[model samples]
Structure formats: structure tokens, C-alpha cells
Target: MKFIDEYLSDIKDKGLYRELKFFNRPQSKYTSIGNKRMLLMASNNYLDLCNDDRLKDAAEKAIHTYGVGSGGSRLTTGSYELHDQLEKKIAIFKGTEAAILFNTGYMANIGTITAIADKEWIIFSDALNHASIIDGCRLSGAKIVVYKHCDMDDLQEKIKVYKGNKRFIVTDGVFSMDGDIAPLDKIVKLAKENNILTMVDDAHGTGVLGDNGTGCVEYFNLKGQVDIQLGTLSKALASEGGFVAGTKSLVTYLRHKARSFIYSTALSPAMIAVSLCSLDIVKNEKERRVKLLENSKWFQWELRKLGFNVLESNTVIIALVIGNAEKTIKLSEKLFEKGIFISAIRPPTVPEHTSRLRITLMSSHNREELKYVLDKLKEAGMELGII
Candidate 1:
């Protein structure tokens, strides 16, 4: 207990301590945290489908029909018709031969990587890959070679130096923090040239990118070319669980061999129903994607015009790099006081000296809400000299 107290004190002294603030309401354009109602800009509910009537109806019906919980791990008593139905819908949505669901995106990455790669294999990873992927590589016992973020030349150079029997290259489809896209076209080309397998964690891209929101792989027109396409239902889909879409053979192999999927309890029936309904909405509603992209572009343009550094973002996720952790926290607090809810992201989620306000836009955010946010941001930025 003394050691734990000392460690917490050290973190607080460093201005890196984090505490949770409860929001006693559903996720939407406006969120109620305690007694304050604020415009939400820190959520991953990019499509604003979390509280949609259709999804709620589906969840309610599922609860009535299927009950509240899955009985056990998928390999035991948890597999049900809803689980198989969601997997099929996901595969069709992703334009893959088949798909399999997991408890979470983190588990999907960890399970898939460790199942396929071993000490004899080499994994060439992006420096800015998600923490789950990093852990996956470590657990795989594979030789990890990290290249500079999105540096194709560095990746090629590292692959040339490695003479391993098997090789896999993994990266995020859309980097979560920086909001820039991976060069998947070039990556696929290189993978083909080197006979190396490829995997993309499209947690942020699914239900947002591409013509019909099929994700980055389909957006790049490399659907069948990439080996593994992984994503989560919690982000844009406004539900819970993760999925891997690929050839029937790959899905079969993971279903049998991935320890995480084998041992973890299946997603609840209500959550599965929510994801299914979300997919149906994503397929039919193109307006949501358009609105989301427009809002993101307008917000980014306004911020950049105010001389704020928004990095190289081309998605709904945007970051204002504040450099110092304490300053970032202060700015976030200021925004909250102004009735705007945004996140102050600090290490080790991001690197040191790169603390930021990670802002995200949803399709449901109106022009008035955006204008208000911008106005308050400008006022705060001037006050803090962040602009």
C-alpha cells in the first residue's frame, strides 16, 4: 500500500495523474457529466448511433428474446445464432470471404498476432501502431522491427535485412492519435513483392471510410489483397466487440486456434443486436458519413486558420498538440468550464512533449455547436498563448 501511494504521488507530482469523471447520461451531441451539460467532442461515437432509436429497439428486442448474458466462453456454451449472424453480416459488409468476432479489438489483435507468428517469424511494425498491436508482437515472440511512422523506405530496408522464414507487417489503418492514414496501397504492393503477410487494425476506419463505410482496405480498393482486416464495433458502430474479416481459411484457423477468442465469453446478445442494427444503418445511410466528414473538415480548417497546429489529420479525429502535460490539462479544464467536453491526452498514450487535446466530431454536431466550440477555443487559446 505504501508503494502504491508513493507511485500515485509521483504521478500526480508529474502532472500525469488521471481520474475518471462520470457522465450519467447516454452518449450524444450533448453529454451531461454530473450537473453540467456540455457539447461533446471527445467521444469515438463518430456516427452518433449510440443512442439511435433503431439500435435501442434492436437491443431491447434482443434482451427480451436472448436474455442478458452469454453463459460462457465461445468454445463452451456462449456461441449462439446471433453471434453467427453478426459474423456473417460483418464479412459481407467488409467484402471478405468470412469473419469472426472477438470480445474486444485489443483481444482480436493480441489473439490473431500471437496465433500466427512465433519466434521463427519477423514482424515489421509501424512506430505509431496501437498499444494492443505492440503487445501482440511482444506476446508472439516474433522479432519486431519498428520503422518510422508511415515510412515505406524504412520498412523495405528492415524487411531486406531480415532473413526470417516467415514475416508479417502490421499497422493501424487510421492512426488513432494523429488521425493520418497508413499508406495501405504502398504497403500491399510491398507485401506482395516480399511475400510477407499484411494485417491492418481498422478500429477507427470501419463505418467511416470508403464509399459505403467498408473501411480503409475497401477505400483503397485493396479488398482481397491484404491478408487480415481487423476492426471494432464499439467505435463507429456504436456497440461492443471486435471482428477479423478475411478468407474462410483464415477465419477458420483463428476460430480454432486463437486463445483469446477460445477462452473469452462471447459478447452479450443485446450488444450483438446493436452492432447488427448499426451495420444495417451504415449500409443504408450515406448522409451520416457525409455530414461527419464535412464537420471534420470545417472544424479542422477553422482551427488551422486560427494558426493552431492540427497535425496531418484527414479524419473525424483531430489533435491540437499543446506539448506540456499540465498546460493541456488546464486547457481541457477551461473548455469544460465553457461547456465543451474534450479530452486532454497525455503520455504514455502518446509520446512525451506531445500532449494534446484529442477532439473528435460526430455527424449529429450542428453548425451552431461547432461555432460555439470554435469561439470558446479561440478565446482559450489566446488566453493560454496556445494559438
Candidate 2:
């Protein structure tokens, strides 16, 4: 308890303390917090389909058919017709031979990595991959050689030094915090030349990238080239669950070996129904992603013109770097007071001195709404001497 108190005190002093803010309404571009409507700019609901009537209807219908909870884990009594359909659909969507579901994206990464590798194997991981990926690599007990963030040269050099018969390279397709796309094309090419297997976690890319919105593999035209493709149905798809798409052998292997999938109770029938319906929406509503990306580009440009150091990104995620952790939180608080909700990301979510305001755009957000956000940001930045 004393150590816990000291640790809490240290983080509070360092401006790294985090607390939750409850919302009275559903997660959308605008939601009510304490009965006050706030402009939400920090959500991962990329397509703004969290509150879609179609998804709600689908969930309602499924509830009538399957009731609430999954009776047991998939290997037990949890597997349903909907799960089978979704797995097949996901395989087709991702252009893989087969797919398997996990409780969350974190589970998918950790479960898959530990299942595939061990102490004798080596893993080449990106420096800025999600915590789940990092944890997965650590849990595997493999030699993890971290390369520079999105630097193919570093990856190439490291791969040369870390030679092994059972080796694989893993990276986040779109880094969650940095808002930068990984060079999957170059990484895939490197993997092929080195005879190393490749794994990509496209948690942020699915439903927001590529012509058909299949994710980073399609974005770089590397379908079926990467050995493992991990993704989530919770973000742009506006549902709940994570999955991996790969060859049938890999799928079968995980189904038998992955602990997370074997031990966890399956997602409820209603949630599965929502995921199924949302996938259809993602496939048909191409314009939503187009407009969302367009708005993101313009928003980033405006923030840069106001003297903010915004990271370069092609997706709906925008990282407005503030550098100082305390100031970043202050800026976020100032915006929240102005009726906008943006998250202040700090260490160890990011490296020390690289704190930022991570602004995510929703498809439903129009120019008028974004312009208002920009004006507020400009005022706050000038007041805080951040500009």
C-alpha cells in the first residue's frame, strides 16, 4: 500500500495521472457528459457507426434469437452459427484462407504471438507498436529486437544481425498513438528476402484504409503476402472483438493452441450481430471513409498552420504533438472546457517528452464542426504559449 501510494504520487507529480470521464449518451461525434453536449474528438469510432440504427436493429434481432451471454468458451459450448459466419466473412474480407476470433485485439495479439514463437525464436518488433504487441513479444520469451519506428533501414539491419531459422517480424500497420502508417510493402519485401514470417496488427487501419477498406494489407496491395494479420472489430467497425486472418493451418493451429481463445467466454450474440452488420456497412459505405480521411487531412493542415507540430498521417487519426506532458494535459483541459473532448496522451503511452493530443476524426463530423474545433484549438494554443 505504501509503494502503491508512492507510485501514484510520482505519476501525479509527473502529470501522468489518468481518470475516466463518464458520458451520459452513446459514443458519437457529439455526446452528452453530465447532460452537457460535448464534441468528441478522441474516439476510435472512425465511421461513427457506434449508434447506427442498422447495427442496433441487428443486435436487437439477435438478442431475440440467441439471448444474452455465450454459455461458455468457444472450445466448450460458446460457438454459434453467427461466429462461424463472421469468421468466414472475415477471412474473405481480409483475403486470407481462414480466420479466428479472440476477446479483444490485445488478446488476439498476445494469444497468436505466444502460440507461434518461443525462446529459440527471434522477433523483430517495431519500437512503437501497441502495448499488446509488446506484451505479446515479452510473453513469448523470444529475443525481441526493436527497430526504429517505421524505419525500414533499421529493420533491414537488425534482421541481418538477428538470424534464426524460426524468426518473424511484427509491427502495427497503423501505429495507434503516432498516427503513422507502417511501411508494410517494404517490411513484406524485407521479410521475403530474409525468409522471415511477418505479422501486422491493423487495429487502426481496418475499415479506414484501402480501396475496399480491408486494411493495411490492401492499402499496400500485400494481400496474402503477410503471414499473420491481426485486427479488431471495435474501432472503425464500431463493434466489439478482435481477430486474426491467416492460412487454414494457422487458423487451425491457433484454435487448438491459443489460450485466450480457448479459455475466454465468447462475445455475446448481440455483439456478434453488431459486428456482422457493421462489416457490411464498412463494405458498402466507402464514402464515409473518403470524407473522414479528407476531413482529417484538412484538420491536420489547419493545426500545423496554427503552429502545432502535427504528425504526418494518411488515416483519420491525427497526433498533435505538444512535447510537454503538463502542457498537453492543460491544452486538453482547455479544449474540454470549450465543449470539445480530446485526449491528452502521456508517458508511457508515448516516450517521455513526446506527449500529444491524439485527435481522431469521425465520418459524421462535417467541415463546420471541425472548423469550430480548429478555432478553439488556436485560441487555447495561443493562450498556453504553445503556438
Q: Tens-digit lDDT track for model 1 on 251-325? A: 999988899999888999999999999999999998999999988998999999998888877789999999999
**Candidate closest to the true structure, highest lDDT:** 2
Please report, as a residue range, the 10-residue window in candidate 1 with the lowest summed lDDT: 307-316
lDDT of model 1, residue 335: 96
Q: In terms of TM-score, how similar is model 1 to the real structure?
A: 0.99
1-387 per-residue lDDT for model 2 (tens digits): 999999999999999999999998999999978978899999999999999999999999999999999899999999999999999999999999999999899999999999999999999999999999999999999999999999999999998899989999999999999889999999999999999999999999999999999999999999789999999999999999999999999999999988899989999989999999999998998999999998999999888998999999998889999999999999999999999999999999999999999999999999999999999999999999999
Pairs of residues at least 3 apart in sequence or in different chains that clash in candidate 1: none
Candidate 2 TM-score, C-alpha based: 0.99
The CA lDDT of each predicted structure is: 0.94, 0.95
Candidate 1's C-alpha runs over 4 A off are: none
